[model samples]
Target chain A: MGNIFRFIARYHLFLLFAVFQSVALVLTFSNRSYHRSWFWNTTQEGTATILEAYTAAEEYVHLRKTNRALAEENARLRGLVEDSKYIGTVKRGGRKDTLQQYTYTAAHVINISFHKRNNYITIDRGFLHGIKPGQGVICPTGVVGVVNQVSRHYSSVIPLLHSRTRLSGSMSKTKHFGSVIWQGGNHRRAQMLDVPRQANIQLGDWVVSDTRSAMFPSGLRIGKVAAFSLDPESQSYVVDVRLSVDFASLQMVYVIDNLLKKEQVRLEESSAQEPE
Target chain B: MRHPLSALLWSIVALFFQVFVLGNVQLFGYLNPYLYPIIFILWPLSWNRATGLIVAFLMGFTIDFFEHSGGLQASAATLLFMIRPWIVRAVAPRSEMESMPLTLQAMGQPKFLTYTGMSLLIFHLWLFWWEAFDFFELFSILFRSILSAGVATVLVYTIQLFSLKSE
Candidate 1:
């Protein structure tokens, strides 16, 4: 034991360096998909508080633009209010399915990075505000990201700009679906892969959320086709999409609450587990 | 030579500056100038290596927390600290290194720039490659690292020069 102590004392600097390096690397690789370490991210209250304060101070310069966006969103919501829906028939006897499968909770983005190799967003809403991992985040214009981790008062979002982010997107005109992915260069652009070559894809054609995505509601706009070409290897069209949500200027967003997501996931899991 | 408390204060200032200011400034949509490595680069040569490594880890971790970049910067910074002594030895004259204080003034401007620039480039290469986590985009990683390291070197060297002038 004394010999071991002497050896350690001799090479203590290298040992310390190794220990610190390994810890940092482990933290890096382990939490690639999502933030596993709770206290070491922007979701932590102290970091979030600082970010929120900075955003608050920075909000003034963008107030006019943000207010304009809010006004447009409010107008759009006003058109869908209860009074706007006309009642054609009143049926008192039949059982009505009134449960909403999805709901929305508004939140403000406190910190965000669109120019990193792997980007993330932090919102003011958290577990206390009913935010949870796997929930979709969308702005008034289009899809933003998905919540990856949650703390008490803030949550981290794996934004669409991240390399690991893959969202189910479909052509609005033809309904053919593909996976949208960011290739780590431009913030306003993403690539939609696995699109069928035969699908009638045109420049400026809209891509929206597919029916199969549990995170997002159907018809939520993702982007528009900026360019496309056939991949000879995969025999599929790889489309460049111009993302609708301008990530640089994004602030306000809504966290999607898929009320029936648990039921749907359970059913799918059970069916998959059964023998084919 | 910097007092230990003063060094600590500079590290804190660099951390916050990197997190709040440089973190947001990405030139041409991709290259982010990481000025946090300045803290590690300017570490006092006479200080305990273990303490320097610890400080490097903590500073890197704090920057990661602010940027939400999982341990990417921390690992890169720690790796730089581990190799820093050798880098210093390689750049500076042995006699001067032993006798003189290892600051910009003692080393003169050109040698100091060489040391700082080389260290910054290697650190950024490690950081960007690890960030990519794959060798498929080797050119992209190299391009980003070189450009960003160039920018960071200028910024850090300018800051060092200003501090030297003030002192």
Candidate 2:
């Protein structure tokens, strides 16, 4: 009726604001999960392209640092090759056909955001390049993140700096396992929780990825314990770790292709299912 | 007020700067200066309320898309637009509100500071609070909100100073 129209006309701005706010809230809250809408994510073509261009322009400033990191990684890789050769020769008698467990694909980081609670990094490699979601990513110093979403030409990674990202980490010396999680304040530091007090944990003990994570290979470096305190309620020691990877200056990374990931996931899913 | 075309051009320039330059600048890890919301603050006061709200929404959504922040910026900026008129009526001079854009050049230094400061505070508090999105981290939210708002207000006033000087 005309009365309704009049009322609408009178408060149309408020109504419009409420409608827009509701839409924005839905987008904001719903996308907090691992599954995000394409429209607001960096994987969207327009935003990705713009970010790529900006990164490319700014890349020159960090060329020296990038070269240093790459050189260090090259040296580490060479050492690994030599070690593998030595192992092969030593175990020549029992060298049955060994199956490849993981493959590494080098990718360029096109864009990254670390200031947000759920930060993400975008790489140039994507589905076409054999990159898939849930794959692990790493750099020269340590583990980077896990692939969360992939398009044709790019993939988004959920970095360890994000609050939602949690990884199984263990002490290198004692093998005591804990959960590494970012507390949303600093990028360089993450908290490792659920470490029992009975473990002989020490300051500066290296923390590495545990064998339990299907996404990442065991023994990948995560960080070094910087501080620790006992939790009164859980009787577990909460430790702060200083991550090795400089997330701000990250440029190049290797995406891990776990060859047995599908098999492992299938087996786990089967075990999780109840009897029919 | 200037021509609508000019305002549109300025907005485009500001958007580009926000998306490309300022978006990348994160001081002290957590302090990100968001200068894009100035577009809403500087919008002509005489423009229609409904049109202004729509414009604010569009601007915010555009920035949110570029930031990949899932409409956080849009929600905060829209809230600012919703409360902007009341803020203007409260702080702005009567004559200035009737016939001028809400820029430092139009309003004197004191009024401009008050207006921009209040608007940016509300925008930033909404932004950081919604970003944290948890009541338990009320202290963290307040801390980050105030720090970021302080930095953003300084940047806004610096830009206003330069713009006024250029004019």
Candidate 3:
């Protein structure tokens, strides 16, 4: 009716604002719930191209630091070469065998954000380059993040500093397992929860990735325990860890492809289906 | 004064500056100066309110696309546009009412700064609050809003100064 038209004309601005805000809210809440819109993220070809161009322009400013980090990483990798080691563990007379369960794909970081609560990192490698969602990523020094979404030429990573990131970590010395989670203020720190009170723990003790998770290789360095205290309610220690990777200056990383991931998942599902 | 083409141009320039340049600057790990709000602040007063809202929404969505942040920017920008008219009316002198353009040179420095500064503060508070939503660090949020507003105010004013034609 004309009355409805008059009402709409009178409050059209407000209506438009409400509609826009609602749409925005939908995008935000859905993204928070991990149902990210495919077209909005940096994976979009145009956005990725712009970011890559900006990174290229800024590359020189970080060249020295990048070179130094790469050099240190190279030195570490050099020590792992076959020529540097003798047969420390002599194999008894048995069938000679070797198993390869992981592959590393080198990728350049195109864009990254560490200041936000729900930060994401965009890398140059994508599906075409064998990057896939849920694959773990690591830098030369330590674990970085896990791939969240992939496009043809780029992928976004959910960095460890993000609030939603829950990485399984363990005390290197005692092998006590805990869940490492970022509490959303500091980029350099995360908290490890559910560590039993009886476990022998110490300040500066290394916290490495737990082998129980197939996403990451066992024993990759995550961080070191900075502080710890007994939780009155859970009767467990809440330990604070200083993350090893400096997300601010991270430039290069490797996407880890767990070759046996599918097999492990299938086997676990099959066993679960059996009656308890 | 309400040239749609010019508005479009300004929107593109501001979006480019915000995503490509200012996005990189994060002082003390939290304070990120945002200059895109200047688009709404200086928008011609005679422009259609509905058009302005639509423009604000699209501009915000574009920024969100580049930042990889979902709808935080879009919502905040919409809210900013909604309140912009009131801020301008409040800070502008009665004598300046006839001037449709809300420019720094037209309103003078004090009123211009107050108008833009208020809008930037509200915009940033809305943005950082939702961004650090789960953290519940209100002190940090307030600090970020005030500090970033100050920096964004300076940057916006500087851009205006450069564009102003000397008499």
Candidate 4:
């Protein structure tokens, strides 16, 4: 008994170190999903105090621009809902056209970074504010980006200015569809590849987001096509597009929360239940 | 009169500042200045090893909780504190190397300051390199460590000067 007791005392320090290292390993490895971490609560509390000190300072400096942007957004949204009522074509003597429907929640940009190769923007709204991953963000003029990461008090968005930002967009008048990608050279310009030459297109032709997106509603204004050419390297046509949102001047945005997202996802998920 | 209690108190203050205040002020993206572990560096030569290790563990664990890096800092800090006695002995002045205070009063300003600064650089190198687990991109890792160390070294020196002045 005495011998065993002495051995335990001698090895206690090594055992303690092992315990601590294993705890660390669990923290690093076990929690790959961002949702699992308590980082949100802690970061929110800390940033709240920090941002409070900056809010008063921002009021006098950022007031005029923010107000004008909000007024412009309000005017544009009213026009979209009131004027452009999409008509449904009847097939087999029946027609189904959902009304112009979209819900918008105002969010303030808290922290943003475009310097990184994989850029992300964090806003001052989160799960509590009806913000979720895959929701589209927009400024007064056009589409901003999509929410990629979300927490209780903050959500990180991948901006349209990123080198890898991609969206499903199409030309307005012509039935031309292409994939939008940022060249990283300029914040305002994104290039669309995979366009077919069969469709009619022009330089100043308007382009907007499509219904193909799982989250963003159809016809959200993207930008205007800037330049186009049949690439010599590849047969597919490529067009330079000028995005609407000025990321440098971005202050406020609206997080669009689709009411039908949950029901749509559940229906798709259940259909995959059958064995392969 | 002995000053062990004062040293312990200052170390707690340093740890609090590092974990709470400095964690929020991220300079760019990856760089986080960890000045708390320097409390072990500035301890008097005669300060106990057990105290240094305990203080280092607490400091590292506090940082771990905030950064979600469980034991990486703790392990590096313990390793640094363990080797601190030998580094101090090697760099100390030949004449006043065995003195109790081991400060400028005992070993002149130049010799004592050189010893303190060099040992600190070595500690920073060990902590940052090990914390990163010797990745291939070692240049940027070392650069960040040096920049953070320079700022932290100034903070430590200021604290020491103020403490000495008060005394």
The candidate that wins on TM-score is 1
Q: What TM-score does structure 3 among the candidates reach?
A: 0.89
Q: Which clashing pairs does model 4 show?
A: none
Q: By TM-score, how accurate is candidate 2?
A: 0.92
For candidate 3, give the lDDT.
0.85
TM-score of chain A of each: 0.90, 0.89, 0.91, 0.74
Interface RMSD of each: 1.4, 1.7, 1.7, 6.8
Name the docking class for model 1: medium
Q: Which has the greatest DockQ?
A: 1
| Winner by lDDT between candidate 4 and candidate 3 | 3
Q: Model 1, A1-276: lDDT tens per residue?
A: 999999999999889888887887877787845465544444478888988999998888899999999999899889877788786677767764676778899999899888888888999998999998999999989999899888878888999987678899999999888999988878889999999988999999999996576889888889999999999999999999999999999889999999988888889889999997
Residue pairs with colliding backbones in model 1 are none
Worst 10-residue stretch by lDDT in candidate 1 chain B? B93-102
Rank by TM-score, highest first: 1, 2, 3, 4
Model 4: CA > 4 A from native? A1-18, A31-96, A99-102, A108-127, A131-276, B1-32, B44-139, B154-167
TM-score (chain B only), all candidates: 0.94, 0.91, 0.92, 0.80
In model 2, the runs with Cα more than 4 Å from the true position are A32-43, A82-92, A274-276, B93-96
True contacts kept of each: 0.71, 0.63, 0.63, 0.13
Residue A268 CA displacement from its true place in model 1, Å? 1.8
Per-residue lDDT for B2-85 in model 1, tens only? 688988898888888888898888667768878888877877777788888888888899887887767888889999998988
10 residues in a row with least lDDT, candidate 1 chain A? A34-43
Clash pairs, candidate 3, are: none
